[model samples]
Target: MPGSGVSINALPKVSLHDHLDGGLRPATIIELAEAIDLDLPADTENDLADWFTAQATSGSLVDYLKTFDLTVAVMQTHDSLARVAREFVEDLALDGVIYGEIRWAPEQHLTAGLSLDQAVDAVQEGIEAGIDRVAQAGLVIKIGQVITAMRHADRSLEVAELAVRHRDLGVVGFDIAGAEQGFPAADHTEAFDFLARNLFPVTVHAGEADGLDSIRGALFDGRALRLGHGVRLAEDIEIGREDQDNTYVTLGPLAQWVRDREIPLELSPSSNLQTGAIAAWGDDMLDHPFDLLYQLGFRVTVNTDNRLMSGTSLSRELALLTDAFGYDLDDLEALQLNAASSAFLPLEEREELADAIVDGFANA
Candidate 1:
């Protein structure tokens, strides 16, 4: 097992569902918060980090999202946004992520008087700075921005246009995130239609806080190329019979379409458990549908939805899955390939990613 050792951090990987506001370093958050006179729940960096974890683990959507208000409050200015984005990439590269898509909503950042374009430029500046730092340290990594529109908010059309406006700079895809239960993807049909007409790639936050109907809306209304935390798609899978080695299963129409279409599921195992997205299944990682989706040939990709809240990295998430499902080096590589292939990048660039994954995993 020399080449295939289970040190998951050393494996080259791709992250698709990571949030920019959710992955800020604790120390940096304290500094930014202090500068802006923002009151925090904890005094020291470690305590603040622990507070984040505790709140996220409270299993309530309200509690889990409370952590973001703090993260986003400090991120109102261009400098803080740049610094946070810079560190986000640095951290991902240190964890051996070769490619990542960092998503955040610009409408939420305009409180500091920065225009939407200015906020994006600030993040781009930080990302480039972070990429340079990683490169100087002798590791190669690439990152792209996914401009997000809040699901409950009505500014998606504006955000979608912003995403398209910056496609050449750093923005890659469009996404609709936040409060997925009462809000459906169809509410933003105009934005999705605009993106579709303009040929912009989209990934909808579906099948996480909601169920199968939301996923159908994501595909039909949002024209989503991927599902964010789509672990709930497992709700549509019916177990027929099971024996010692063979288990028969059936996919519902929605599940069948998702599987046959091979739409990548950006399943964040830890975040799913933390947010109670998998509560119906159970409270443990063993109860996660990640292995079931993988066994059924779904394009399953592993991710860390919010590194800070979950107290995890991509490496740590993979390690958790490995522990829960007994996954090995090959399994990790397969997930990376799934993510790379499903990236919003151009087909040629995606193929290059595939080749890089092949080369990296070959060493394993």
Candidate 2:
């Protein structure tokens, strides 16, 4: 997998659950921090990157989330948000992501006096700029915005309205993020209802920091179409093993629903390990439930939940998985197909993306 030498980078991919704030370049964070005169956890970019990785490795959901405070602190201004979004798209293109849905909480970006509309517009502008840049370079890429509301905050209804208002411009979906443990999706029932009434596609961050109950709330209450890191849904599986080749498996009600419905789980291998989302399974990539889910016919797609923090790209994550699980190009293509099918875009657009992935991997 390692010696493939850019094969992974050239293979087309679909990104379903990458975060805009969490994917900021470390150097950009330094520059943005300097502009705001904010003190960062590390003085140098290298140290800052290391600090982020360490913080996320704490195995406690709260400690893992603390790293976001620094990233969000510098993203308060319109210029900062625009720059981050632009670079985010460019980074995705470089990682061979043909299409991506970038999710971020607009409510968090309003501290600099920018209205919710202005924040969403700024990101749209950046996304357009990045698309133009890629086109100029003779590479094609597409991106859509997933406007998110912080679940712990009280402004989800307003943010949901913002997302619906900008659907035609660039926004493609709505999500509830932040503190998945205490702030259940039920807490944002108003926002969820607003989104549901508007018929906007919704993907909720569930089963990462919480358990099956949180995931249940996300589906039944939030009406989520896709699950963000629903890795912990593995908790519902009871596996009984014999010495050689004989293993019994039983799925709980929640797991049965997710698998029966083919709900896509955005499985970020490195991020899951760093955040301890897979702690109940094991401490390494081999221990992830991704293979289990895949074998069980659950829709599973690989992702880099945070590129900068995890020091990964979509290509790198795929390569890592290939190395861990002995997956060939066929396996990779199936994952891309899963992501393309689960995208919030129209059916025609999703089909186009799926075709591109097929052609790219066929050539690779």
Candidate 3:
């Protein structure tokens, strides 16, 4: 509804790549930190949010990741985890997200004597509470937890097992996050193999801090059903002009496989720019490979990798794309449909979600 006077926030959307720890409310962080007497870089909520956004936009994935230290520090206990999870759902509901998959590393929430199962249970409790709240507010929203393992850590197999054990509770999928450069998905072979054998869904953090090789490992080693910010896959494409008014494009094997298979690319515009994932293209949104990838038939879905860090929502990301690429309502609907198809849900549920998105967008 571009110029039709409809706000993007009112449209139903699906969020596939949001991070749980990365989407904490700054005010909640302040409150939680006070109970634990945890030191913070800023005391005020606004100031702390500003600090996180500043740190995240430093154009280095390593530096951007450091901001998580503060958010994760406050999420060690059961109550804090549940509170964060609840608020995460509430915030997404406000942003018009009909469905969302919140990913977080259960291994990181173990500093407060929480067992792996205990952490998962706490998050599920929070999620259920949030869902009830949303229903009370006369809105419908669905959430699923995508348990993650730190790529640099050696506990991926255990985390994968944790996800499988909790699959019926609330957990939906598995992911290996953190550094994606040297610690490729190959390092977590046992975990990925186990997930595959169990028929569990997976999405790996690749093509963000690394190139096509990392993406390849994600496919071959991790067997990722989706690529978390697979922006760097564009590196495998070569675009050239064939004439003054014509152009030609060639896709490498990796890019071809991803496109042909319709593997979703969880492209986070602000997060990608902040982490320098699209630095080869440029710093601006227009330089994003999103438009190119979309035009080239890649199943590119919009996401907010870390809402707190990037200061964004799924709606805002879609609006940014429209502004940068002159997209209309149909374009936005296509992106949401991509996300709906990419969700880690049963085929019937995904179809229902897709129908809901279409109906919502049509009414908008």
**RMSD of candidates 1 onward, in order:** 1.5, 1.5, 0.8
- Residue 278 alpha-carbon offset, candidate 2, angstroms: 0.9
User: What tens digits encode model 2's per-residue C-alpha lDDT throughout 1-364?
Assistant: 7346548888899998899988999999999999889998898889999988888888877887888999999998888888999999998988888999999998888788998999899999999999999888788899999999999899999999999999999999999888888999999999899899899999999999999999999999999999999999999999998768898999999999999999889888898998889999899989988888988899999999888778888988998898888888789899999999999999999898899989888777
Instruction: Point out the higher-scoring one by TM-score: 1 or 3.
Output: 3
> What are the runs in model 1 whose C-alpha is more than 4 Å off?
1-6, 242-246
List, residue by residue over 214-284, the lDDT tens digit for candidate 1. Answer: 99999999999999888899999998757788878999999999999999999999999998989998999
Q: Write down the lDDT that model 2 would get.
A: 0.90
| Clashes, model 2 | 0
- Model 2 segments beyond 4 Å from truth? 2-6, 242-245
For all candidates in order, the CA lDDT equals: 0.92, 0.90, 0.95
Candidate 2: clashing pairs of residues: none
Q: Could you tell me the lDDT of residue 31 within candidate 2?
A: 97
Model 2 lDDT, residue 72, Cα: 92
TM-score of 1: 0.97
Which of candidates 1 and 3 is the stronger one according to lDDT?
Answer: 3
